[model samples]
Target: MLRSIKARKGWTARAPDEDFAGAAEEWNKWFDADPSARQGAKMPVRIAGMKVPIAMIAEA
Candidate 1:
């Protein structure tokens, strides 16, 4: 996800301020964290200034 965020044009290149990597590491420490959060989550129409990847996931 961070890599994808980095690839976007004009997107700022910086570490996530919320400690995403640490959170992910903690979650994975318990179980093989499912990458399926996108399965049912809705994407915002626009995030910051970019059109979100709404079509990437299934709609609720």
Candidate 2:
């Protein structure tokens, strides 16, 4: 199935031939540089019938 659309615009580009460690390192570097990105989005999570923001949960 994947081969059928292999020539598609993003199909080939989406799958990069890089190791997991290398990719994770690159992502960590970007995440560290972007301070605002560290602040988790205001998405709510339901716990014990209470809607809590994800950032609050992350802090704990």
Candidate 3:
């Protein structure tokens, strides 16, 4: 018999005023929407106009 492996959702750092759910949403919106900014650069959440800290492990 074999055991199936399930996907484990990771975490992120949220702003004091924001919760994890909201922060995750903002993170996804920023990164998912052709997230390229600053002439093809990978910058931080500041590009999204968000001060909330975040840590993401994407499939890319």
Predicted candidate 2 versus true structure: per-residue lDDT over 29-55, tens digit per residue: 534443222222222332455442222
Model 2 sits at a Cα RMSD from the real structure of 16.7
Question: lDDT of candidate 1 vs native?
Answer: 0.33
Off by over 4 Å in 3: 1-18, 33-60
What would the per-residue lDDT of candidate 3 be over residues 2-49, giving only the tens digit for each residue?
Answer: 012121233445434436456556545555634422111223344456
Error of 1 at 48 (Å): 25
On TM-score, the leading prediction is 3
lDDT of 1 by residue, 1-60 (tens): 432231211111223345445545543443343332422223323357653232233223
Pairs that collide, model 2? none
Each model's TM-score, in the order given?
A: 0.26, 0.25, 0.28
Query: Where is the poorest 10-residue window by lDDT in model 2?
Result: 5-14
Candidate 2 displacement at residue 50 in angstroms: 46
lDDT of each: 0.33, 0.30, 0.39
What candidate 2 gets wrong by more than 4 Å, as runs, is 1-18, 33-60
